[model samples]
Target chain A: MALPPYAGPLETTWYYGFRFLCACIFIFLITPILVIIPLSFNVEPYFTFTEGMLAFDPDSYSLRWYRDFVNNTQWRHSVENSFIIAISSTILATFLGTMAALGLSKSHMPYRSLMMGLLISPMIVPLIISAAGMYFFYSNIGLDQTYLGIILAHTALGTPFVVITVTATLVGFDHSLTRASANLGASPTVTFFKVIMPLILPGVISGALFAFVTSFDEVVVVLFLAGFEQRTIPRQMWSGIREQISPTILAVATILVMFSVVLLAALELLRRRNNRLRGIV
Target chain B: MANEIIGGDVVLAADGTPLKASLNKAMRKNRIRALLLVTPLFLFIVFSFLIPIVEMTFRSVDNWQVGTLMPKTTTALAGWDGKALPDEPVFAALIQDLQAGAKAREIGKVGTRLNYEKSGLRGMITRSGKKSLKVKEGPYKEKILKMHKKWKDLETWTVIKRNTAPYTMGYYLNAVDMKYDKSGEIVMRDENRRIYGKLFLRTFAISMAITLICVMLAYPIAYLLATLPLRYSNLLMIFVLLPFWTSLLVRTTAWIVMLQSQGVLNDLFVFFGLVSDDNRLQLIYNLTGTIVAMTHILLPFMVLPLYSVMKTISPSYMCAALSLGANPMVAFIRVYMPQTLSGIVAGSILVFILSIGYYITPALVGGTDGTLISNQIAYHMQKSLNWGLAGALGALLLSSVLALYLIYNKIVGVDNMRFG
Candidate 1:
């Protein structure tokens, strides 16, 4: 697995050339995302760079699109429903996925591998198949076309992620801490709530954040199961892209990118803290 | 304490003996509790995910159509051979059998349901024998052939006449675009039936290629973030995660708008003096656009895994190598790269596995040519109403993914890798 050393000019050039390609590609991939923010405030809506043109002007930097996005009834409703569904689904997925991770963490369990595979199977299966399966199952159960219907579906999809994250943190857990708490005369439930919960808090919080983002962004399954009342933001966005024309969508998209950036930064901070606490740094 | 250990007191006996390796025994005993802890997840998955998928999968092989009606004809035709043409009575019976299939809610049902799918089979089956053909009948074989050449084929007769042949591997074979010849052995597809299978492969290959591209792009950025000063790293990290909240539809649309003939990229090209004012590059509605958009969307999948791996590599190891007289590049290649292989492997496997099941990005950006295998499955489920074929394809995709998962585990122990 070792490579020849960069010994002389020929080797250094070869190494630097390969490294340069990597750097160039890495920059190219990141560029498309940054390109949008500037264009959002561009004098022209196009992504072209006009020579000798820079800085935001009231003429070029129009708030009209932003205003339109905020005022549009469909966009507003989608945002509202997206927040509601994401928060609700996050709660359900985090609680269920965390507890399930705990239960599975018990070394005495008989069906662990089989169980882990099943929990993650929802993730592995193609979304459209699950979309079809859920369509049939929910319709038969009389849960179709309802907010709870979408909630349960999203919860099912998101729970595996929670299980994955929490289970990961739990793998780093020290069994002796809980045992010591128990030996000190605290009950098992109290020990879990006080000692274990705090230790795994980052994992659970990150899991919840993931669940929220997933539910917020999910479109295919939502499109399949959601009714007019239950349509989440992604579903609504999909509709606008397909059936409507608007500069408002651009504004809304820009805001969404900013929001994701903020949330993801917070998530990274939590993760880094968790790593520091565990002394993995 | 040594005396106590020899005394076989509560602790000693509970822990077993020096001869027994008590730690090993204790771990052995705890393994079952581990399994028990994980059971509720198992049950939830069985009911919520596995059962539904398995039920759908079983439908692929189940001769549900033949089983439902004319139980007698199902029995009679169970072993009926297609040698010197079907008998006159058997031909009459087939007309009745087709009617019975339609009545049983099997034939002409779901396939042909989606817009993008080619519903060739559904149209043929549903449209068949609506008005019996008045063949010029000097030859009985030619007369039967006049109605349909497909019916003259032996495999078609066997497919229709079989009972609930739960053992039928027909669906499994067709899932990969291979099917049984008249002798009932799997073979490569007929020359005429080439494009559908080729499209599936093209989709799979494109996804794999995109996954590779994403890994190549994301690894360095993840490496920089992992190693760099915290302040700058955080800023870069935010940009990396920025697009997640941006609706994928919006991102995809942005790409479309930029890549289109008269779109932003064209304007940029002209303005930059890279090309003539009017000329535009073909970008959208091709394999390249699909690949670019998908790679953009899934870059995070690669970055997070690579970052986690890189983070665990102690800076001291590289410093140690440099101090030992190795140059920076050599130190990284020999020491750091090997350490980060676990991450690269993990990121590659994760991205590759997810890519195969991709649908929307390809559907939006690739157009007709860019469609992945999943699109075909969706088409079968929705448009063609060929739940059977859809289910078969689903099983095929699942098995391949599972195989890849197993391979990944072997290469880098699954339990060791942190997905975050």
Candidate 2:
């Protein structure tokens, strides 16, 4: 907000001071993330900028770390594993969560709040406890260290986002359209495909993206449940941070930052689309 | 009109059933259909998520090793007093139990369980199990006692006798750094062995610190976001959302890159002549690193709720206070701050709960002194293979979080919770 012309010097100083404080906080929020993008390209294997880099010498920058990340079999395999696990879990979580959300949004659904709580407990409960619990139970069932176990665990973890997002979309939903479709002699299945699906598609897709990110970024469960063959990107990054501090990790981090940017843009688009569908924008 | 005809205070459908009854039947059908749709995920969560946590919690007291593995010995010890070593019949039962346990190759679990209560019992049990197999005749007491001097100690029998029940508080006791003394009275562990108590306190302290710091940093930014024009605010919002959207490991790695001794922060400090170049400040892998990294990571959580709440607060409240002969700072504090208390509470509790349960950031950056309780739980699970202790620690941490979560639900309402 701009200051009024009648403002005193003290108020003007406070306004500028507040803006300065906010700018500092914003820098604190973003600098750590932004600083690594350039550091990742350092020709020298250092976390800080060299004199040459600060001076803008072209020799100070290189794609060596990115090349290393691409050439490493472990990193490549982890990327593959991350996608396989994240995608499979996202599909399962979205399906189960969407159906459950539809039911939850219905007024006649029994124990609706209780059921919602139970469904979303995965997100609320601490990741370590969930991981520990699953570790023991999966071991008992001979599922630990398997792709199925990791996928199942992540699916359980991801469903809450889908449920929440889809349920949110359903909150502003008009029931008359579905009833009108039925009155027009459309079957329930056909009405769902023609009406309900198009309406909630944005919510479902955004929820799926959320689930994908949740599973993709998850490492605690993977640490407990995954063996070497099932190491995800975060799992590899965990060890990479713990065991070896290297520029390759910076490259990987930069790539992940870009990936999240894409995901964020997609989610924002879905949100805008949802608002438009609801005629709020 | 025939579909619902009013007749003598009751309406009739075309099929002649009362309209009210038909409507009730339809509602019941719809309810059942809704329940059916929810059942698959409900059952899936119950089996996969809820049941596993319940089972893990049960392990904290699931003392089956001594009761099951040494069943004969447990039965024999039933009649004996813990005042002294057992009699001849007890030794005979012990020999039989040991022979069975060793032959089945399941006695090590018993050893491991007992080792948690009292040291040396694991080796004693395993050694006696093997030595008992060689005993073919009577006078087994002398043979067992000779096999291990621990057998002669009254505390050994006491430990075993205490664990003979199907369930014991031994793991929970150990989890809190308390144990039964030789005389069977519960007492705090020795000074050097006591860890979990301090770790629990430190976890709370660190979480509280992070929560307070996040609120402090988040308030001004969130306030700025709430008051700014939509376009600028949305642009500024990315600063918060980018980190929120980024992978957790990526942020942590970025923190490590920035906070390490020779990392970006130190280099900047050195360039500014803040300190001598020879001795860079130790920042990462310590308490500073954890607090800094976690605050940055959890800051967005604080900002979003506060921003949403602040956006709803009309600025006229502060203006009215200003018009009523109040100074700008005083008016802002009295009028504006009180309105945002709900947001402050919601964000504080959210950040606190998250930081309390935080593991990875602390593990990667928190060297020996800075780690939280979750890292300890992981250690017990992975390295020590002490599942019972891990379960106990997890249960304690989970209970606190659930209690806080209930409070959060009461205040913020989980249904209203949204992620960026």
Candidate 3:
């Protein structure tokens, strides 16, 4: 707010003080993320600023950790596994969740609330419990420690984001357009593709991204369900941090921070596109 | 077009079919179609998610291992009174069952299961199983007592008899720091062995502390974002959303870098003469580290809901209060604060629930004293190989979280939940 000239010193001080407080909070939020980027580049294997780094000497920086992260076979395997599990689960979750969202949005759907609760519960329930339960059940069924088990477990965890996001997109959907297409002798499948798909595609994509991230970032369930061969990035990082303190983790963390930035940008764009499609912008 | 009245109450369409019947048929078709669309996912979740948790809950009270292993002994022991141990028939049945159990190599499972109740019984059962195979005659009580001194104790028999029943509350009792004592009475565990009750209380206390810190830290920024012009607020929103979007492990890793004993924070403090380098503060792998990292991770949860609520609040109300002669602090507290109660409650409960069940961040940073109940549950599940106790602890944690979730759903509709 613009300050009025008639404001007293107390008001001015409180306003500036409050703004400063907020600025500090924002700094607190961003500093940890920002601090790692430079630390990840430090030539020394320390997390703090060395004298050379503070002096802005070019010798203070190196890509050793980044190179180590890329060259390590374990890290490479984890990255591959992360993408494999994330992509497969996201696809499965998106398909199942999109259909469920469509049904849930229909006014004629019976017991929609109850169905929604059950579908979204995986997101709400504690991950450890879900993992523990899955560990027992999947082992009994001979699926535990298998790739398929981890993928299916992740899909179950990821589906709620798909349902929530897709249902949100469907909220502003115009039903008459689909009805009009049906009335023109088009079959339900054809109308869904030509009319409904184009409008909700952004929502579906963003929902898929959400599901992808959920699977990508999840480690607890993976810890329970994954074999050593199926270790993902977070799982790898978890053990690395516990077993050894190294800048390689920071380098990886920096890379993940950048990846999230890209995902965040994509989500923002999708949101804008969604709002424009719904005529809210 | 003909609008025909067929029966006294029936209205017919131009096709001569009753309109009410047509409407009902169309509605039923839509309902079926909707249900069909949902059925695949509904069944998938039930099979993959719901059933597993139900099975886990059942495992908490499931005590069939002993009964299955020693069926003959269980039935024979059922008839004997608890006074001064069982008669010779009970001992005879026990020897018979132990010999068979040893031959099947399943006595180990029974021993392991019973070990959760009385620690030393595992050795006794295994020893008795080995010794019982040598005995070929009746008068087995003297032989069994001679095999192991533990067999002479009445408490051992009491525990064995209590577990022979297919379902028992023993696991749940152990979960809450209570177990059956020597006289077969439920009592709190000895002071040195009690862990879960204290862990539960600590989890609650830590979660509440984190929630309060989040609210305090998030309020000013949420207010600033809510009050600023759209352009500024939109830019400032990134500071919140970036952290919200970052991996939980990444944020936790950042905190470790910043808060560890030879880390940047300590280095800076040492450089600034705040403390000598020889005695750096022990900040991480403890409660302070857990609180600091969790507050950072959970701050966005508080900010998002508060900002959403604050965005709906009009600025004119504050201006009106200011013009009405009430001081700004009083006006903000009395007039503006009440409007944000729903956001405050929703955010607090959401953070509290999330914090209570938190595993990754705390597991990484929370050393023995700072660890929550979930970590203990994981310990039992993995390290201790005590699935029954893990299930019991998980069931308790799940119920409390679900209860809070239901309350959150009541206050703030779950559909309104949004994430960046």
Candidate 4:
């Protein structure tokens, strides 16, 4: 958007002003994320930049917080718990959600919209309500305070992402490919493994990534259902922020930000692959 | 011969099965396959998610604990009139019930259930349970009234009688900031005890404010991205997607670091002589902090949908309108803004719905007055151990969100939802 030579002075002024405003908004969006990266490395216990840091002193920065994050038993336990819950829930959610998505895409499925609504309700319902409901119900069944309870709770929460993403992928899928394989005398299993999997694998993997992230970041349900032994990364961060603000949390946040960067890159690549496969690009 | 040939007419497949029957059979098989594929997840959700929520709703009204704990008293109270305190039989039943409850160590639970309706009953019940063992003779009514003067009040009897039923609306009543007053009429709670209604209103107000701020911040950027060249827009999109991909805890922590009184923002202000070091603004741990952090976190949700919608809108409409003798501002307001209304509505509703149910950002920075209804629900579930009231509040929040979601699905179509 270059200014025309015949443009009035007011139009030019407005154009420059608008761009400046958008620039500020962009700064607002990205600065919070970028600011923490430096603060996470600050040697001072303060959340703000210290005078030494402003003067370009190398002594102002250290890896002690990151080391603390690793060496602390509580943080290590939560990291382990996070991976265990996220990985297990992701597997269960992907399998069940992919199957349900397969079923949903079929023209013969009954009451499709209603079923989709029911499957996606967990995502739409407020987390507090779900946690409250699950607390009373799970406690009654003796499932609360157990690892299995948190995993199952997360599985329920994660399935909606899998269902949505996988179902989106299946929308572009060519159903006749499966029919063609079957007509060539391949078994149903063989057709799925050979013809269908190749096309929808990107969607499945991205959906699995979404499920993994959802389970990894979720805290409210964990707060309600998890015992001390089952605390995850988000749960630990939650308590840390509530009870005390520590630089180690910033270190942990920095690491999680990096983890999300990797996940985001993978998702973007998978999205591009999907679009190319569908000939949209 | 013609009639016989017409009557005998039929279609058949190569396997000698009728075409209609074979088609029906194939359709049935497909339906069964689809059902089979969906059944596992369906049953899993029902058992793990749906049933729990339904049971929570039931728990809100399921007040059988008092009645069950004092079964003999409940049966005796069923025959007594509510005009005055009950006769000796009701008192004897009460004493007998207290002795049994104390022996079982369940009297405290009964007191807690009743205290939600009538205050001060918990202490009365607990005290009476301890002293009931000392009284072993007749004339229990006078003895009970002597033990606790609250026994002489007819309001206590009304509350106990109301809760003795298998089902009660006391929790739901309390959820809306109302309760059953004396004479069994529903009335508003006192000002000091009133919190939920105010919390709900505050939640709505804060969410609306966040939604408005997000739209104001996002509109120009989305418009810029939409109208810009592809290379430039793609480069600038990282600003949006990076935050979208980052952990929520990290963003919130960033805000804490930036907005705290002695944090970077205040430091910058002080360095610039904007304000003296003696009086830094109280920025974090308040409503301002909640609004700023939530708007920052939710801005991506607003921009993505608006950008997607704006991308489909060609620039030629504005060009034509401007060329047709209309000013650029008028042309934009008339032509471009109307086209973007759907996007605005979708983004606003999405952000509003998300903000209303928010727990983390508010819990972190929303000190006392800034906390929303979700925080209160969490407080009840964890701190107060008031499960029934928590369920009632949760049920209300869930329904509002579900209602909005249904409308969202109807208008925008959930299948079109996308993530960056």
* Residue-pair clash count for candidate 4: 0
lDDT of 4 by residue, A180-240 (tens): 8988999999998999888989888988998898899999999899999999999999888
lDDT of 1 at B234: 68
Q: Which pairs clash inside model 3?
A: none
Checking candidate 4 for backbone clashes, the offending pairs are none
Residues B256-358 of candidate 2 have per-residue lDDT tens digits of 8898888889998998999889989999899999999999999999999999999999988887897899998898888899999999999999999999999
C-alpha lDDT of residue B379 in model 4: 93
Question: What tens digits encode model 3's per-residue C-alpha lDDT throughout A57-160?
Answer: 99999999999999999999999999999999999999999999999999999988888999999998999999999999999999988889999999999999
Candidate 2: CAPRI quality band = high
Q: Go through the candidates in order and give each one's DockQ.
A: 0.39, 0.87, 0.84, 0.82
Which residue runs does candidate 1 get wrong by more than 4 Å? A1-29, A38-57, A272-281, B1-39, B85-159, B162-167, B180-187, B243-247, B314-332
Worst 10 residues of 2 chain B by lDDT: B1-10
Candidate with top lDDT is 2
Candidate 3 — which residues are off by over 4 angstroms?
B1-9
- For each candidate, what TM-score against the reference? 0.82, 0.98, 0.98, 0.97
lDDT of 2 by residue, A162-254 (tens): 999999889888999999999999999999999999999998998999999999999999999999999999999999988887899999999
lDDT of 3 by residue, B1-420 (tens): 236657657688657678877778889999999999998899999999999999998999999988999998899988767788788888888898899999999998999998899998899899989988899997898999999898889888898899999898998999899999988899999999998888898999999999999999999999999989989998999999999889988899999999999888998899899999899999999999999999999999999999999999988999999999999899999999999999999999999999999999999998877789889889998999888999999999999999999999999988888886
Question: Candidate 4: where is the Cα deviation over 4 Å?
Answer: B1-8
- CA lDDT, candidate 2, residue B78: 99
